[model samples]
Target: MRVLVFALGEDDAPRVVQFARQLGAVVDVVVAASHLSSGAARIAGVGRVLAPDRPCDGSAEAVAALLASLASEYDVVAAEANSLCGDALPRAAAQLGAPMVSHVVAIEDGALLHPVQAGRAIAATRVDPLFFCTVRGDAFAAAPLGSHPAPIVPVPAPPAGDTIRLVRAAARHTDSGLTQARAVVGLGRGAANPAFSARAAALAEALGAAVAGTRPAVDAGAVPESALVGQSGRSISPDLYIALGVSGAWQHFAGVRDAKTIVAINSDAHAPIFEWADYAWVADLEGALPELLAALKR
Candidate 1:
C-alpha cells in the first residue's frame, strides 16, 4: 500500500508520515515547503517527498487538485488535522468522490479510530482504499530522522485552475506558541487596561510564561484574540497556569481545565476564580504584581 500526506503547521509532515506508515509501508509525503521543513524526507518510513520550490501563497486549491490527481496511484491520501488540511483534503475528497475520515486517532483492524463526544468515546470507521483522511495532531509522534535521508524531489506549483487567487498578503502578528508553553499567564478583565496589562506582561516575562486572555481582555486589546483562552479559543495543557483578575466562568475555565496547577489572584474575595484554583490570593493585582515582578527580578 502507498499513502500521500499533506503537511502543515504542528500537525506536520513527520507525524503524519508516522501515521501513514501504519496504513502502508510506502509513505510518500507532500508538503508546503514554506510551512514544513525539507528535512521531512529523512524520516524513517517515508518513501518519497513532493515539495514545491516555494509553497506559493494561495496554492490550497492547487495542492488539493494535485492530491486528487494522485488518488489513483496511492491507497490513501491523508494529512494531519490542521487549518490547511481541514480545508484542502475535503476539497480533494470532493473532487475524487472518495470518503474522508477526520479526527482519526488510530488505525485498528483495517479501520480508523476517531474520538467522539468531546473525546469521551471512540468510533471505528472503515474507509475503502483510495480514500482521503486527516489524523488528529495528537495521534502520533514524529517519525524520527536518521543518518540517511531521502532525496527531496521538487514539484512545480500547479495552476490554481483559474479559481480564487491571492491579490495580496499581510502577515498576522504572532505571540509565543501557547500550546507548547510550560507556563501561562492568563489575563481577565482585571488586566484589560494598558498599564495593568503591561505590568502583567512584565510578570509573565519574569515567570517565563506565555500570555493568554479572556474575551474582555482581548476586546480591550490586552492580548490578541489568538492568545484568548476560552472554549471558543485555543485549549492549553500547561504545567502552570496563573489567572489574574479573572472571574472563572466555565467558558474561560474550559480552555485551562487540563492545567497541572492553577493560581488565581484577584482583589475581589468573592471572585469565582478562587472556587477551583489550586492556589488563591485575594489581593489587589496593582499592588501584588509589582511585588511579584520585583521578587522575580531580585
Candidate 2:
C-alpha cells in the first residue's frame, strides 16, 4: 500500500515517514504550492513525491489535488496534525469518503491512539480500512530503525486549472528557538509588561536558554510572536521549560507538556500549569528572576 505525507524541510520528515513505514507501506510526499527551502530527492525511505497538479494558490487546494491524484493509487493518506495542514486533512478525507482520525498520539493493537483530558489520558480508535490518520506531535514512541532508503522522485506539474491564486507572502514568526533549546523561559499575562520581557531576556541569556511566552503574553504585546508557546502557537519539547508568572492555560500547557523537565514559578500554587510541571516554585517572580540569574552564574 502507498501512503502520502506532507513535507516541510527535514524537521518532521524523520518522524512522519517513520510512522508510515511502520505500517508496512511505502511512503510518498506532497510538496507545497509555494517554494520550499529543502528538496527531498536525497532523503531515504521516500518513494514517489506528488506536487500540485496545477499551480495553486492556497495550501488546501494544493494538498487536495495531490491527495486526489494519490487516491487512485494509494490505499491511504496521512498528514501531520499541525496548524498548517490540520484543516486540510479532515476536509480532504471527507471529500474522498475516506475515514480519518486526527490528534493521534500512538498506535497499538491495530488502532490509532489519541490523548484526551488536557493530554492527561489516551483513547484508542480503529479506523475503517482504506483510511489514514494525522499523528500528533510527541504522541508515541518511535519505532525501530529502518535500513532501506527509498528513492525520492519529483512529480511534474499538472495542467492549468482554476486554482487558488497566490498572494504576496507574509513573514511568519515562531518560537523555533524553544524547539531545540535545553531550557526555556515562558512568560504570561502576570508578567505582561515591557519591563518583564527585558528581565526575562536577561534570565534566558544567563541560563543559556531561549525565551517563550503564553498566548496572552504575546497578545498583550509583552512578547513577540517569535516567543509564543501554546495551542495557537508553536509546540516545544525542550529539556527544561521555565514558566514565570504564567497561570498555565490548557492551550499553553499543550505546547510545553512534552518537555523533559518543567519548572513553574507563580504566586498561586494551584495554577493549572503546575499540574504537568516537574518542579514548582511559589514566589515573587520579580524578585526571583534576578536571584535565579545570579545563582546560575555561580
Candidate 3:
C-alpha cells in the first residue's frame, strides 16, 4: 500500500507522518517547507517530498486541488486533524468522490478506529483503498528526523479561484499551545479562588504544561478566555490531562475525550469528571494544592 501525507503545519507534521507510515509505505509527502526550520523532508520512511512553489498559508483551495490531483496514485492520503487540513481534506475527498474519516486514533483489524457520539464509543470503519483520513495527533508519537533527507520537488500551486483570503491573523489565534501540549493543567470552579488559581499555575509550571480552564473558571476570572476548553472552545488531545477542581460537563469532556490519561481532583467524589477520569482525587482544592505542589517539587 502506498500512502501520501499532507502536512501543511510544522507542529503536527511529524506525528501525522508517523501515523501515515503505519498505514502504508509513505513515498511522497506534500509539505510546507518554508514553515519548517531544517530539512522538512528528513522524516523516516519518506522518499520524495513535494513542496509548493507558493506559500501554503490559508491556501485550503490550492491544497485541496493538489491532493485531489495526486490522490489517485496513492492508496491512502492522510494529515493531522487540524483546522487547515480539516478544511482541505474534505474538499479533496469530495472532488474525488471518495469517503473520508476524521479523528482516527488507531488501526485495528484493517479498519480505521475513531471515536463516535462525542467519544461515547469507538467505531471501526473500513473505507476503500483510495480514501482520506485525518489522524489524532496525540495518538501517535512524532517520527524522528532521519539522517538521510528526501529529495524535494517544487509543485506549482493550482488556480484556487474564488477562495477566501486571510488578511491578518491575531497572535492569540496562532497560539496552539493547548492543543499541542503533552500535558495540560485544567482549572475548574474549584480553582476559581485567587489563591487556588495561583497554586494551579505553579503546578502547571512544574509539569511543563499549558494551563486551560472550564467556562466557569474563565468567567470567574480565574483564567483568561483563551484558556477556555470546551465545546465552544478548542478541542485538545494531550497525553496527560490533570484537572483541578473540575466537575466534568459533557461539553467540557467532549473537548478532552482524546486525552490519554485524565486525572480529576475534586472534593465531590461523585463529580461527573470522576466517572471519566482514570484517576480521581476526592479532595478539596484548598487543601490539596499545597501538598501536590510540594510533592511535585520534591
Top-TM-score structure, candidate number: 2
Query: lDDT rank, highest first?
Result: 3, 1, 2
All candidates' TM-scores?
Answer: 0.68, 0.73, 0.70
User: How displaced is residue 205 in candidate 2, in Å?
Assistant: 4.6
For residues 130-240, what per-residue lDDT tens digits would candidate 1 score against the true structure?
A: 788877543476778866766677776555452333212101112345656789999999878888889998888888899999989989888865577755455567899
Model 1 CA deviation exceeding 4 Å by range: 9-11, 34-37, 58-66, 160-180, 184-204, 210-236, 242-259, 262-295
lDDT (Cα, 0-100) at 65 in candidate 3: 81
Q: Pick the candidate with the highest lDDT.
A: 3
lDDT of 3 by residue, 1-298 (tens): 8888876555566777788777766557876433442445788777778876655545567668878878888988898665566677889999999999987889887899987776678899998878998887767888888988888888765554523332111123235466679899999988888999999989999999998889899899887655577654556888999999889998789778878999999999889999999999999887899999999989
| Candidate 3 to truth, TM | 0.70
Against the unseen true structure, what C-alpha lDDT does each candidate score?
A: 0.73, 0.65, 0.77
C-alpha root-mean-square deviation, candidate 2 = 4.5
Taking every candidate in turn, the Cα RMSD to the unseen true structure, in Å, is: 4.9, 4.5, 5.1
lDDT of 2 by residue, 1-298 (tens): 7777765333454456667876677877665532431344334567765555343434555555556556666766776555444555666677788887766666687677876665667788876657756665444333333455344345644345634442211112222444457788888888778776788888888888888888788889877664577665556788888898899888788778888998888888888878877889888877887778788778
